[model samples]
Target: KSKNPPFMQWTDEKIAALAPNDSTERRGRTLASSAKWNTIATNYEAIWGECKGSGSQPYLVQIKLSGPKYKCSCPVRKPPCKHVLGLFFLFAKSSAVFKYQAPTEALKNWLDQQSTSTVSSASKTLAPVLKTEEAIEQAKLAKQKRWAQRVQLMTSGMDELELWLTDLIRQGIANTDIQKASFWNQVAAKMVDAKLPRISTYLKETHLLIQQNQNWSEVVVARLGALYLWAESFKKRNLLSAEMQEELYQSLGKIIKKADILAQHPSSKDLWFVLGKKEGVDIEGRSFRKIWLQGQKTKQQALILDYAFGSMGYEQQYIVGDLLDGALVYYSKAYPQRAIFESFESAKIYEKTTLNTYKDLNSMLTSYGKALVQNPWLFSFPVGLSNLKAFVNDKKELQIKDVKDRIIPLSNLKEAIIWKILAISGGHSVSLFGEWSGLHFEPLSMLTEDGILSFT
Candidate 1:
């Protein structure tokens, strides 16, 4: 067994941070046991290991600690795949298990290739190919043409949607067969075809509300009113301020590319705490993930949204409760929240003594109302509250009560989650973080004695 100290300082949480998703993290944990590896060795610069798999040949994995780069012979395309994470976990747990060995020729070749590729990529970036004046003008014209065409399609689609909404209101909400899928699906399909996926999502969610809620008549009316307002806003979008116009575009599902945001927006550097994460597949079968972060210094919140098509996974991985030392560039909006990382320097486990939270429910709601005033289309707003007790009200609904004894109902959450919260609080006050929709709160995570515990 090797007697040298571990080359890098890594903990189990740090290794978990490298996993792209919870599934990968669990797999890595399962493979962390020493018996899973056929061989494990380390040199001065790197760690290499081989693990047996279903295939005839064992999968080889290598980690270069300086760059923290990883290479695996497994078929997975994503870097730092489960095998690599497993090796990291092993080394982090017990480096003595790895035998000290000289660099093998194969390992040496891989290292040399990495160095050469790094230099080559840097040179290419430093000397990017510049387009000629004619090429630039042509590209500009092409982009303008595409935008004009898309605007025309969107206008027609919004017109159709407005007519549909008018007819629904004229025909009376009671007359419409809300349970029938085709009634909503037909219009939603048209919206998708019109390249207005965000409106399509709204329609689907309205349908779900009608199906799931007892007082859906009121909910449906409010939802449709918002949709109607959005359609009208689209018509007068040109007259709106630039920031409001950007908000409207985002609300309509127009994607602002990361490169564009990074190039245009100012970046804020801070020690950001990973608060919570939520992920699910939408009605369109596209998988989406949202990670929430709060800056320790600026106290600003940011939302990182990611989407993947069929069989594809998210590009980055983040573990809740970790601290990221980085800079983030936010998308343009009346009230900026969505952001993309401009630079990620380092990440580690957070060792904070206290959480930043609102004093009470009233204070949190006041802040939320202010945000809504800035961006009327805002749906869900993140909030954290301290000294709140969770319990079942007299109506048998799960709710949280603040220090002032004012209570707020929770959103429709799983029974398990509700019970877990109640159990954690034990009729006492606990700090909690979640999204507030002005109507109900949806708890995602809670700060406990140990650390932040995620519910989803």
Candidate 2:
């Protein structure tokens, strides 16, 4: 049997998952044709290829199987550019095409450099620092000063936002020209300047809802109500619980550094199953990925959110349905869900078995209601229901119906994906997992007797 690692055995779906966006995935697919490569070779440790590109010389592409790291001579700023992806796609299709050979001198040099850098970085990270008592005190005071300044800025921003909402309400939603982009952009820009990016996103989302949905007035009113509630809560934040205070800070776009979270928060170790993922590009042109994981023994759900800017990819890659042994440290929140890996061990295919799912839609909804009571600003909640049937409603929208005949609409899904789910179900009940946005359910994956199929 071959000794290649699990990641070396790449599949089309896996390749697509690594892409930063749909457009990049498409471009990679286009470049996957074997004829585009002048050479394809592999060793136990790495895969190397030379692909024909716009440049005069064939771009040299090398992938270190251990890091699954990519190195391409192409000028593209984005990692795992088309050349690297194309090489992997070709290798996945026919590994026999890649002759086993020693690395070329240039490839050897790149590999050696990567090894050296990895070791040096690890050493620096593991090294401890000695800080004098005075130095520590100075740092603590500086942090407090920074926090006080931020509080002042955020307070002013919230006051301005409250006044804007009041004016908008007085003028009335019907009278407002919501169609104009500036109606939302101007306020969103102000929020950004105040370092309240999360609030800015809410305004932008509200604008999009008005443009896309037919019953937008209700949506807008509900959103505005939430904003008003948050504003009122901020005024009384001093009386809130520590968890609620953290939630408020996050809502105002304050980020707790990963190192701080790892140092301060408790870590839970468990066999975690990669449930599914969602990817999208934000208004700033940065790509974001949300991967949902469920702990097998603890039955706890955690979200791993990662983002990448122009030409960069996410720091980590998670394949749906894989089970990993890891410890996660969750950020402080009223209803903690987002987490980062504190430690990671082995990963393997999740053994198909019974999953912890809600008995029905009512059970899931009740649980969600409780969570909402804890974190009023919760955007989306993960849910899994067993024996749910997928079907299209009269309005040509996809929905999942429970045994009670109660149904919830699936949000923002393509017709093709909807039909695929229907075909998989064959009019029979199937286990479904997804996120519930108070208004609708978005099916991300489905479980079958055979295995789990990802719909993301």
Which one is best on TM-score? Answer: 1
Q: Which ten residues in a row have the lowest lDDT in candidate 2?
A: 117-126
* Full-model lDDT, candidate 2: 0.78
TM-score of 2: 0.83
Cα error of candidate 2 at position 269, Å: 2.8
Residue pairs that clash (backbone atoms under 3 angstroms), model 2? 78-311
Give one digit per residue, the lDDT tens place, for model 1 in 209-299. 6776676776787788889988999999898899998898788898876766776788898888889888878777778988999988888
Candidate 1 minimal-lDDT segment of 10 residues: 118-127
- Candidate 1 vs. true structure, TM-score: 0.85
How many residue pairs clash per model? 0, 1
The alpha-carbon lDDT assigned to residue 223 of candidate 2 equals 89
TM-score of each: 0.85, 0.83
User: What is the number of residue pairs that collide in model 1?
Assistant: 0
Candidate lDDT (C-alpha), each: 0.80, 0.78
